[model samples]
Target: MTGLGWVGQVLTVEITGFAHGGLGVARHDGRVVFVRGALPDERVTARVVDDRKAAFCHAELVEVLTPSVHRIDPVCPAAAAGAGCCDLSFVTGSHGRELKSRALADQLRRIGGVDWEGVVEPIGSSDTDAPQVGWRTRVRLAVDADGRLGYHRHGSDEVIAQTDCAQPVAGLTDGLAGLGGLRPGTELVVSIDDAVGDAAPARQIVQIAAPSRGRGRQRRRPRTGPPRVIEGGPTTLRRVGERMWQVPVTGFWQAHRDAALVYSDVVTGWASTGAEVAVGWDLYGGVGVLAGALRDAGVAQVWTAEGDATATAVAVNSFADDSGVHPVTGSTETVVTGLPRPGVVVADPPRSGAGRAVVAAICAAGPDTVIHVGCDPAALARDLRLFAEHGYRVRDIRGFDAFPLTHHVEAIAVLNRDR
Candidate 1:
């Protein structure tokens, strides 16, 4: 299949195609396919970027012969113009909820190879389908040859620097565009909280990191640390109730304001299912955010652990201030394996998913209940299976539309020992 399907000429796609984030076709061979800047029921003209396989093609949108009713002005200009943010303006805002819900389901079946469909129910906003539009909180940008600030082209090394993002937290983007063109040999990172709202009190900011030239004899990579350069992102302290969390600008923090409250509420409510758990463990404790929640919820004797030093320090002080919550520092695998064995274990692991070590530890401990918080449904599904095979039973699985756009959804699963 090798032909423009019609070069530079527009084709009226019936708006019927998609298989996960990738494009798809029912059946066709020897044709160049183009998709992007497409809408339902609209005709579009595309430029072929690459043609391959029997029935697929890559394309760039040249024009829309007819736009779909669902199509609207993109909220992020970067979504339309920046390569890195290529999908920024994809579909209507409301479509975010819909697409993400499906994306989660699809990932489990297609990526994780789970045959069960609808094993998870998506919990969406009752008021709206999409999450907040802007103030992304953290952004990674590339520096141009002129040492100016900008973004990386969608698929190329090219730079498209900008001063403002539609999604930047308030006050943070100020002078951001101007900070480009550094003193030479350095990097830049920006962090903000949209929740603070404009004109509100300012929050804490650690410091930014400086970059180094790459592949040189003097160019040595910094040890794994916060994503930011200040030797790592500036130390950030987040207080949840009586617990204070020291997170780096580069470290993970819930993007939406009030989301932590929402998560904490859910975990506390779920924990009520059992009392006197054989053990109480918080995985991916990340400054013991959940552990703090456990303390507030009145759950005692939790072995809370985290990896980052700054985060762990925050954990120590946060829980130390309370005198009831306990904290440990190390990898989740090690923490889980060495635990004294409780009836309940709560974890919110990273996007890549949990590993065999954690799974084995869980199996070995054989807790009566397990609560898992995950961002990737596919990875979650895989880990769920591992837990199931080890004697834990998945009692319930539900999702939270955390990041409204960008094909991401978060989930929480409760597993029982059925004893």
Candidate 2:
């Protein structure tokens, strides 16, 4: 059938495998169908949502004819109603992590030609019984026309107002009640300082962004003004081990409470190996978390590069006491060429992953060690292949189930240059 003919049509198919973006893989009539809300080894009936491509189409699960043993009742009502927050909430936490591991391994082997047989390790919490939920320290919510705060539907701009999402930390969503009067289409960036113990009380920070202004049907201009702070202070505290950082409420920070510490430790361990590392480069270094790790690991000089000026200012102020840590504000692709050559380079690029130009630049710099972090498995795999073209061999790779109850996973790969 043609692409347009498949739209709105329902078909039953057996899911043979999982895809990177939490979709189930199935074949029907010589075309691949990506079905949401379905799991591998299960038979599901799904409605075709988009069939723009002739080779494959997108679908939404309608009915599960054969549910997997790992499937369970969704923990959050919003998720059950198709809110985009907890895409994998229907599966057990262990099973979800297992699926993520398999997905990551598949990406590495297929796209990067690197064999990986590791599992995605879970980040634990004090709430042992409900560890998967209430772990998100940061959340971005959309305000609908009715002034309700919620998340957008999957692959859509329509907002689904939600008062109870399972992914946020405790009390992070408490401000949702008082947020009804905000302008329609405005965005809310909510953050919390989830430090444990009596010394540091949990504090919530809320920032509001104005609705994007544009002519009808034209592309909306980016929000130029900074988000106005509504609740709490302008900055919130986040700590990794003994070090503390005052991250701006509107600035970038790890969403999971324990993600900073976990990733920092991982980067430290990986960057510490190999020959004497005098100088290190931290690309896309937000607030200098991993750069601090490099410094702590005895790198004499560390240059942390971030594009956001506000984030770079925070990093500079946070590291003012130590001159060895230099925070520069510029695109990594541009700033990397002017900086002094380093023995090791650590890059934590955005979800799009570091492109070929950036990867080629890093390779041209001739760093002895390269530590790459990626949130998207497919993008990471592609970049790994690019690095391989530049003579970097993968040494160790680890996956972290940082965003629990969701399909998102964080992965870090350590690579060493071939001598």
How high is the CA lDDT of each candidate model?
0.61, 0.86
Backbone clash count for every predicted candidate, in the order shown = 25, 0
Candidate 2 at residue 88, lDDT? 90
Best candidate, TM-score: 2
| Candidate 1 TM-score to native | 0.78
Quote the positional error of residue 146 for candidate 1 in Å: 1.8
User: What TM-score against the true fold does each predicted structure earn?
Assistant: 0.78, 0.93
* Model 1 stretches with alpha carbons more than 4 Å out: 1-19, 22-27, 30-66, 86-88, 110-131, 180-185, 193-199, 203-233, 241-243
Q: Write the per-residue lDDT of candidate 2 for residues 265-348, one digit (tens) a residue.
A: 988887776557888999999899999999877788999889989899999988889998999999999999999999999999
Q: Compared with the true structure, what per-residue lDDT tens digits does model 1 show for residues 249-331?
A: 65677864445667787777778754544347888887777776665545667888677666777677766757656677888
Segments in model 2 whose C-alpha atoms lie over 4 Å from true places:
1-4, 125-131, 200-202, 210-226
Best by lDDT: 2
